[model samples]
Target chain A: MTQSGYASERETTEGRVFTVTGGDWDTVTGSVDPLSNEKIVVNMGPQHPSTHGVLRLVLELEGETVQEVRPVVGYLHTGIEKNLEYRNWTQGTTFVTRADYLAPLFNEAGYCLAVEKLLGITDDITERANTIRVLFMELNRISSHLVWLATTGMELGAISMMLYGFREREYILDIFEETTGLRMNHAYFRPGGVAQDIPDSAIKKIRDFLVYLPKKLKEYEDMLSGQVIWQERTQGVAILDVTGCLAMGVTGPVLRSAGLAWDLRKTMPYCGYENYEFDVPTATTADVWGRYQVRLAEIRESLKIVEQALDRLRPGPIFISDKKIAWPAQLAVGLDGMGNSLEHVAKIMGQSMESLIHHFKLVTEGFRVPPGQVYVSIEHPRGELGVHAVSDGGTHPYRVHMRDPSFVNLQAIPAMAEGALLADVIAGGASLDPVMGGCDR
Target chain B: MTIEPNESSTGGVPVSADPVGADVNAPAQVPSSPRKGMFGITGTGDVSGFGGLVRRHPEIVGTAKPYGGYFDEVTDALEEAYPGFADAIEKVVVDRGELTLHIKPERVLEVAQIMRDDEALRFELCSSVSGVDYLNSDARRLHVIYHLTSMTYRRRVRLEAAIPAGGSLPSVTSVYPTADWQERETYDMFGVVFTGHPNLTRVLMPDDWEGFPQRKDYPLGGVPVEYKGAEIPPPDQRRVYQ
Candidate 1:
């Protein structure tokens, strides 16, 4: 209510205003303006929701334009490869499956193929098992791509698409959970064959999913394709041509989007992928929009493969006949958890002493693989997933290295993001679909 | 000789104890090295009679000419394309439907350049670059494996180079720019320095981290885990299959 030398008041026609405190603040105003420098550094993640898992991007910004982008990974590193060295050959699937959480089947398939090759038993893998692998891997590809579409759409301001994307993804995950007993990190694949046969319930769920997904995919395309905002955000943003993709070792949909039809399924068939007839989709624009189209098309292609694999699925033993490498326990999830079935347990416990001893020895100390190394690559959702496995004629792995597609494809971020608008960094990264679990494994 | 207790004190590193007396016809024998049982318990732990198992660390012998399938064509093409191939190539190992061309560490760059540029052997894509630690098996224990794919030919070839720990291998980043992060990862994990890489920093591990985590001798350090107040030893401290 009182006016002193520290406070001053001014009256206008409409109102009265007061100014308070020391006005001659030269020290506070002496520093240069932050906007005047024309360059700023922004750290975008490791915690940000849009970064996808724990990827950190350090960007040098020149007023909303990215001058340089340095992607810092390894925050999610769990040393799965190192841990694999301590486990038996069959137990390796558990570790590798967790590497690429989005595409666990791909990781398992690649690792198993490498192990089978090392044991010189590639041809011995049952046709039914291989068919099952193709079936699950194709389903995994669709689920992984759906998450990519959903998250990328959310990150680019289409919130509703994210919900729809996840809804369809949940259907696929339900199929996975019913079959493998876990939704995300299913180590269903084993060295000689799959851990068990696909149950009849899982088949029914998959058939239902096969019908439900195409309609959802059409709905997604109709919703986002003509939206003006989506078009402006994606088209011509973060463009990396075929040459850039090749130089950065970008594969899968990103490389395909850059106009190279180099899908390992087509070029180098594995797990009887050649048996299924599907087209490798490509887009020439080499931008975020192109990646979107390519991934969406890939989902359709995966659905086609899944349908064929379903039809070709014949009734046969899923595990290899070789008793040496085949898992001893007939695994089934009990009320407590996954364990040996009652019949298998009863047989091993009461029937023959030799059978019990054999089962115990095999389960604890697995069959030894002949010493050698092999690299097996499978086309994962993100790119080419390669497993470099070495066995020193032992039950446990000597060394196993996974060349995860997310790890290799993330290297192209700087080439794709630099000199583009800062917001496009998120777009480009989302387009690349870098899963940090796979990248840092 | 008396055995020492609490070997876990050294953070569960292998004791390098003398092997048992099951030394019948083992090629590279020092002693009978039986893997310790669970919780650092030194015993056969092999109830199924695998204790006498002598694992075969088969020395990779290069296959003689006509190296089967497309391998022969790739070799012929490389030999015809690059004049220095004879000197650059150390060994040609064909195993399990895959071809491995072991090259001198110093000549990796030159060999890669030729492998990429040559019309006959155009491995345009270097699919994967990784390092393996063959700790006691080889004198040069650190091996860098490069998996190259020829999209034009639809063929794959493995080029590998073995170098001593801390030895520098010529970086193939010039030949395959994609080898950038892979070389960094190799450097970070196996400590194999890439001589000519543009930015050779740790890509996977933190900058301040010490010791290559993936090396065979490097300990997989972890505190003993306890379940319901009963302590269970860590993996390294537990039984190992040597």
Candidate 2:
């Protein structure tokens, strides 16, 4: 039996080697042999039009295919981890929320979960608070995925997707601003609980958004999925199997797309995710297209989760009941912005001296955590976002390190990009969703 | 932390905020005094109860046998599987329902390989590799901690190894390839070298940047922020709770 085609196959020590141009197009390209060809090294942006966000790629290429890829990261380092050592436990949320600027709530939730575990108050978090956390986290996941879709679409020359993606994301940001007083780095998920309760207006907005987004998603699918160029650019491109995903520590949708439903929310079940009823969407393609499909499907799954969370939203205290650990002042919407309710402020400042002192004591010298360490991980939009926090029985953290999903999942780039076409590198990198803010933090 | 319930001075009482006392889980560490001034306050501003404050780290002590939950199964599996389990395993401290195995620095690579490939231990995912600097309080100041996740069993375990200043540990990147960048990040932040890393240059900091910034003794240098009326010093410079 002989195997002969446009690209002829010959047996060699390395196994069956394909002579790509040897059969039909011999004279046109002179029997092109990749092994003998001189490789050209191409540097693609710490600042490129594709906008992987300060990511620089060094590629060794033979013709149009990438022979090897070396990714140069840390261009956006902000020292969030080192700076966290100087702040108190509660104040730590503000610093960490900025680590992965896109998925801010996940960072806060993961940090708070670790801190709560260290404080021995993991089980003590209020019901309403847990619901709110889950609600906001799922919402943030949608927004982050939208940005991924938008930016990735822009990079792949799907200009309409870029516009539609950002346009849909604005709705979620509006809700965030209404609830947390900011869009991106809302440090709303405090250690004990959320910073404040979700207002009726935000709730109404979310309810409206839940209904509005599904139709918009369908339109997006109709637009993006129906396009042959989008499919051609993604399908079977940047392929990575389940083993490659695992060995390189890739998780979240990239792993999920590789046909493993290894979601921390399902497997580990922190933040009372066990109580929620939602399916983990997955695809078996293990390519850029699979990741895109998985992400879009995930947004739908998240919308379902968000709807359930809203239905289950009971009116109880948002923060923990323990006054020693929870925020002292009542958070309210002032003319300037979110602040202590005017009546509570008046009572603290003028009406009661003892109240003022207690607030000052708790606020200034944050409640001391017991001397111990704990690592808490949550499924972020990218992957397993873990926070390894250590305390020295002091108000401030002894050490805290975020094993960010972007940071870990970015490791799979070389595994995915090498040997693929030069264009597929961008598709593969985008599918991994490496937000440099998270990667370099 | 209930390794020996009877040996505990508090007598079945849980590990509390009472930092000065002896607990069963926390063996007596090298005594380090509290900050002399109050909450980063300099000058002889005497007696604000900060003098009496003793902020102690949770000491690393071996928990007694039949360690509860999946911890027992993990240790027993490692014991049966690896010949040098005792020699390699320093201490197993189970705190907050999580298992932490303190391993010898040299044996980290072998143990990591075993932990990954063994059917009984299948911690295939190297979830995180980071370093912590417990400066002034401990003699071996720099400690590298690895968080491993077993997807098959949905279990998580921590491996901690302490090394002195300028000390190096065998790289586990051979066993778990995910540790490549993380080990580099640790090297970048704490200057704890991973001996067999393929390319061990700094990952986060600039190439020419000097000093390990995450070390506790390393000065956090910064200029103060000023408003129209008042000036607020940088976090490292200002008075804060010690």
Candidate 3:
């Protein structure tokens, strides 16, 4: 054993010493190296506070730098698409609204649009209904962007911004609660039209919200825009240009932030968005800061849309007159929550047998959509929320697939996170503003 | 056709005066049964007695020249740009103010490439990729639909490719990188394999999860909870109107 490469081990000293000229430094350095050369795998969460709602990022990091990032989602997959198959055409609103909790109206609107398209009743949808949809959707955009601002701000060490963001969001939710009944996941939008007409109280609340949000938005800008920490964290960080955004199908504030005015509301106008007098906001930085600025500007733009929608709102039917497609019982806020209006219920049940039968049949069986497939995309708070609905001439949907913006936009995580500092990963992921429910639906 | 009393009452509900029956689920198969209701549930108890009535699913039919709006322009540009236009495109369907090009499954990638690259076509963005399962109706039941949007022309065209179960289709990731996750999701839901997709894995479903959930045959799995000892069937097992 001792008669190896280094002649012999001489025991002149306290311990045996051997000097070798032709030593294998490669193997020596490779085996006993520090954690710097050795790549470390970090699983950031299916359950962590900062990763934004059940999103798990598998990051291979070399110290502070992320070598590779693989986002492992599906923690919040409730099988909404599969569940939609089991539900009726009207019941689908309830299911779809839950997909993206933040922007539930957009989901409902998209699903309803697809259903209307399938039924060939798109043109039949009332002008008042379209205006209502536009109004609520802009409000939802503001609330969603507020959440984005709050969460991203919190992630990047702006704790006060989160509280401010949520405070403003609560105001919008109050408006939603007044009209749609439930604050979030309101199945207000139906296939034919909306569940009910907007009450005068809700209209007043919305008007107030429109006025209140602009001042708060300005306060948020004044608070966070000039801060050194905020600037350092967001500016020039998580940069994904227009080309990348387009290639990855990223839209909404993220795409707008990249300087491409490809807003679906502007380019592919839906819900009478073309008539609204508002600008599509954009920022050229294509970074976290750009997204923040774009979202804030969009809130201002949305406020303008809300005002226009309010002005455009006339005394007309909120739902289509189609008795076959329409939900017979007028939905109203009950003590227990949203249910059929008491007056309508009394008339249907006590007064007329035909009315009772009609209501029962419509409520239970639901109206059939002729066999056809339609794809309807609406600009959601996150991005382009597309609904691909197919009907097999049944009460229930044959197949309904939602191209959720959160789901599509989450793919850009690796592209944004790789080669960036570990801290920037939080900023980039926050900037995407992914609702895991939507991403995993 | 004897209109039931319920049917007559329902007719009072305002439907469009002129419904283009040709556009919707056109019943190719006329039911032999005279009883009208969903899934053969006929008579008074049922609300909408459309069960026994067979709906004709829309078949892939090419519209004649003036496809109307920008459809004709798009089809013409694609026809001129792509060499094997006739062989690649099975049918050019214009319905609901939307242009649908039913392309051969094997030739989908080529068509997508042409749709994206060709200067005239200029379909810069592939908006969505989804799968639909037409169980028992068509031989090629699974269809992969690509919604292509052209920023230059402000036009949207739907490109569809149909294939049987366990069939392979080329990935259009090369042409539209956005298809990366869309294809995976489609694969996860419908089990449609995209041959060239970099990572075609289950997106929404758990890695170890069993079967594609969105397929018609796949049941919406859930524990049936009894209410006051009354056994209410799960949604999939319930007596559906259709």
Highest lDDT model number = 2
Q: Estimate each model's TM-score.
A: 0.89, 0.88, 0.88
**Local accuracy of candidate 1 as per-residue lDDT tens digits, A1-441:** 446666677787878778764455545665767677889899988999899989999999989988999999999988899888888998899999999898888989999999999998999999999999999999999999999999999999999999999998999888887777778788899998887778899999999988888998899999999999999999998899988988889998999888999999998998888888999999999999999999999999999999999999999988998998899889986554457888999999999888898898888878988888899998999988999998877778888989999999998999999888988899999999999899999
Summed backbone clashes in each candidate are 3, 0, 9
lDDT of 3 by residue, A142-211 (tens): 8999999999888989899999999989999998888878999899999989987888999998888877
Winner on lDDT (1 vs 2)? 2
lDDT of 3 at A80: 88
Q: Mind giving the per-residue lDDT tens digits that candidate 2 earns over A1-441?
A: 266555667788888877665555657676686577678999998999674789888889998889888888889998888788777898899999998889999999999999999989988999999999999999999999999999999989998888999998999999989988887788889989998889999999999999999999999899889899999999999888999988899999999999999999999998889999888999999999999999999999999999999999999988888988988988876555677888888999999999999899888888888888999999999999999999887788879999998888888889898888889998999999999999999
- Span of ten consecutive residues with least summed lDDT in model 1 chain A: A21-30
Name model 3 segments beyond 4 Å from true.
A1-31, B1-55, B222-233
Q: Relative to the unseen true structure, what is the C-alpha lDDT of residue A275 in candidate 3, on a scale of 0 to 100?
A: 87
True lDDT of residue B50, candidate 3: 48
Judge the docking of candidate 3 as incorrect, acceptable, medium or high.
acceptable
Q: Which candidate is the best by DockQ?
A: 2
Ranking by lDDT: 2, 1, 3
**Candidate 1 C-alpha error for residue A422, in Å:** 0.6
Task: Candidate 1: list runs displaced more than 4 Å.
Answer: A1-36, B1-53, B223-233, B240-242
Deviation (Å) of A31 in candidate 2:
18
TM-score: model 2 vs. ground truth: 0.88
